[model samples]
Target: MSTGQVLDQVMDIDEVDLTVDTEVDVNCISKHRSKVHQHFTKIENKFQCNHCKKTFNIEKYGCTSNRLKHLNSKHPSKVEKDQTHALTQKNVILQAFQKQQKNQSEADLQRLITRFIILTDQPFVITEAQSFFELMAFGKTNAPAIPSADTIRRKIFAVYDEEKLKISQKLQSAPGKISLGADCWTAATGKSFHGILASWIDADWNFQQVGLDFDILNGNHKGKSLAASMFKVMNEYGIASKLMAITTDNASNTDTMFLELQKILSEN
Candidate 1:
């Protein structure tokens, strides 16, 4: 909208005095390369003007419309070149997005592979199978290649340890005393298993529960066996001092288990 002679020099954005009353935050722009800022950035739809420091909601008025109005009125030459500059920058931004997307896709692959292994009871080495690679390759995912079985295994263990730590902290930080529920059963394979879970309200008053232990019972389901397993979980999370009550089905052994637990908790 400027005069022809001044507009002719619009090609060089570097000359524009893009200075503001206050500096514009990098987040004030979409995740695109900015000629003026020259940084990777993304902003909320509502942004404050860099020159005026006035707040505007891009969604209510329109995304980028306020920006355009400012550019056209204050720096028409810059506006004249914005479309071309944005076009030139598009390819560069796209390449960056592609690279980021590929990495995220690969991480998702690791999680999916872990879930598949657990749910299907498949061996850890199944990841190295040729059919898995072929199936994933045909899906056209951005993941560059199928991870080796060992890589998937490492990822699974890393994720498990991280989650375990989080659960431990949550139990230790329970807003109130925590309650426990436990169960024991023998599987069709004739292997005995026992599991324990903790339940408590969070600081925000939201009830939450998480399994603290699920392990094979190598010995008979005696009171001593149950007490040992329960003690292990409580000790791991340091929740013995915070335990409010323990719940179990009407089993004779469970009654004995509580008596044994009381002795252990008292001695500690």
Candidate 2:
């Protein structure tokens, strides 16, 4: 063949190979590109923005970093109190609502009670409910009342006591080696009392206070009554075994109690 004709034939063969290779490469690239595009589309559809009440295409907010930022920028006026103070105020409102439901009709009290509960439990304070009447009459067209701080305090204590008892029971039921810690002090009445505390490590390796009892002992530091009081708390909590340790200050009665505890453990 002539030189020009030979060069043309070589070029035709090279073009044929290039065309076949490019088609395969193009198909593989197209497949991966389609997968990447679908993955992002799915993520965009699921996420929504809590602030601005806008439904976003992504799984999380694209504009702000966190809920706090959304609240500060979008809901500025409503975010007046810090998180802790707002929670405390909500607790006060819920307590008042729970107290007022006893003597009143449910139909008459539902809105006020529900509002009080929501305000008290939420992380914001719409308004304060200081008393039963105040809580009930709140948001009424004619008049509104505010609860007293004293009443709020009393309601909080009621909840506190109930929680304390539940915690004590949970500690008693826990299975593990327990310990007793004791401290002493003189009250304002000039009477001396010993405070005994029992504790144990839970499954999560956290030390929990299982039981506590205070006893007023007549200047007699070495009295059997103190030992009895300690034993009473242990028995009430159903702690039948000798604890791993008993921690207390240097007192003759405390020493005696340890010796007695040792004897009890030995018997078991």
Candidate 3:
């Protein structure tokens, strides 16, 4: 059997919906033609032969018969016929794919771990639990190494910063005025924090919302104090001038907060 046929059996290539969560590259390759792929360079919608620099369109499912015919007719000497060498070459390709799959799986595991810790408000040390290790080892023989508490902390902060950057860019490009809603609450530890959310319609007419700030309230939760903190968040995103409206609970402090914000806006 050809290397492509063997790869098809190993990977079990099947037609799948693109809408579903799937690795299109691994599962959608035409007939598992990694052997042909190794000799050709992909150029946009076509693959270019490395030897002749001629490009060919991929048939419906990634068929590379034209490329194979070219190689057989024009580069016959390069084609190996010995089954033993063909098997070794197949192993090499499979090993490359295995290494790539391992790296990809490791990255996905890290992201899942990061999201679990952040969304659950769990401590970074949760990754160090015996149960966590056993859970990772449940199905797989060789589970990827769990990151240390410090590593998890770093990853969390990195993700936070990266997401914040995305939100900032979106806010900058929003088509209409950005509306803001803010609330303050005390955590179980008695430490107070204020969260501000900004919402706006994008150029595509899609409504978008993002948390601009969720930081510790330094001094007091009074109107002036809250106004000061909110101002900083708006200024950081450079959206103070584009503010369409502000929303907060109907409290005496909120009325005072708006008044103070208006004064601050005028002074700027």
Candidate 4:
């Protein structure tokens, strides 16, 4: 054939191929776009699957192929639902997950509130205050309701007991004897009380101090009375045998208290 005829044939074939390619692309775009979008949401520039919440980049992938592939492989049944139904289903699933997470965090949140109250010296009734509720709501939109004041008091005692047990165990396992400190004072309410603290060196050679007791001392703050109160705390913690030294103010009664403690120790 002559060159012009050959060139004409080549041009005709190229035109047919281009037309077929263009038609196929248009068909794919029209048919797959709605189907793919049914199970996915376009957020910003990414398509996130409603069922799985997996995001596909719109810039790199042009929004349909990756999403369709994700639907077919990961969520085959979800692709058949209409757009509105799929979106509602996604919201339901997400809400359920968030609710479950919130429920799980409630105990932790309560403990944190207890710690906050203790650290701030706030009254337990603070939990019942509307201002506190507003503060909590301001911090978290779905914050759990604050427990009643009585409930908070019980939690405080429970935490105290748990920590006391832990401290008792630590004192029991201490490598060295525990040093005891005691002070007798009258509270603002004119109630006499004895406060006892314990200091010890741990197996790790770390010095640890813990408040052991702050019990009401009904009678006099004399030597024998203070000795008995301090020893009671030591016996309660199972640490009377681990006493290294007693520390107190240089009152004449403190000397007698030490003598009384020695007599008691010798007798025990």
- Clashing residue pairs in candidate 2 are 44-57, 47-58, 47-59, 90-120, 130-147, 130-148, 131-147
- Model 2 stretches with alpha carbons more than 4 Å out: 1-161, 259-268
Sorted by lDDT, highest first, which candidate order results? Answer: 3, 4, 1, 2
TM-score of 3: 0.55
Model 1: per-residue Cα lDDT over 1-268, one tens digit each: 2223333443344433223223354344333233433311224654555554555654442334456666568767765586677666554454554555565666676788887886787888887888877887663535565677798778778877888999988887787999999999989888888999999999999989889889788777898889988998899889998999999999999989999998998998
lDDT: worst 10-residue window of model 1: 32-41
User: Model 2, range 114-201, lDDT digits (tens) per residue?
Assistant: 4454457732222353455555465342332343444444444565577667866776666787788877777788887878777777
lDDT of 2 at 196: 78
- Residue-level lDDT of model 4, residues 1-268, one tens digit each, is 4434433443322111112223234433333325565566667656677787877765544436766677778876666554566566555555554555576466787898889887888899998999988887763545566787897898899988998999999999998899988888887888888899999888988889989999888776788888888778888899988888888888888888888988887887
lDDT (Cα) of model 1: 0.71
TM-score of each: 0.55, 0.39, 0.55, 0.57
Highest lDDT against the true fold, candidate: 3
After superposition of all CA atoms, the RMSD between model 1 and the true structure is 17.3
lDDT of each: 0.71, 0.52, 0.75, 0.73
Candidate 3 least-lDDT 10 residues: 15-24
lDDT winner, 2 or 3: 3
User: Taking the tens digit of each residue's C-alpha lDDT, what string does model 3 give over 1-268?
Assistant: 4435556655533443223123334344544334555677766566687878877764432455667777788767656542355777667556655554465466677888999999999999999999988887664444467788898999999998998888888888887899999999888888888899999998988888888888798766788988888899998899987899988888788888888988888888
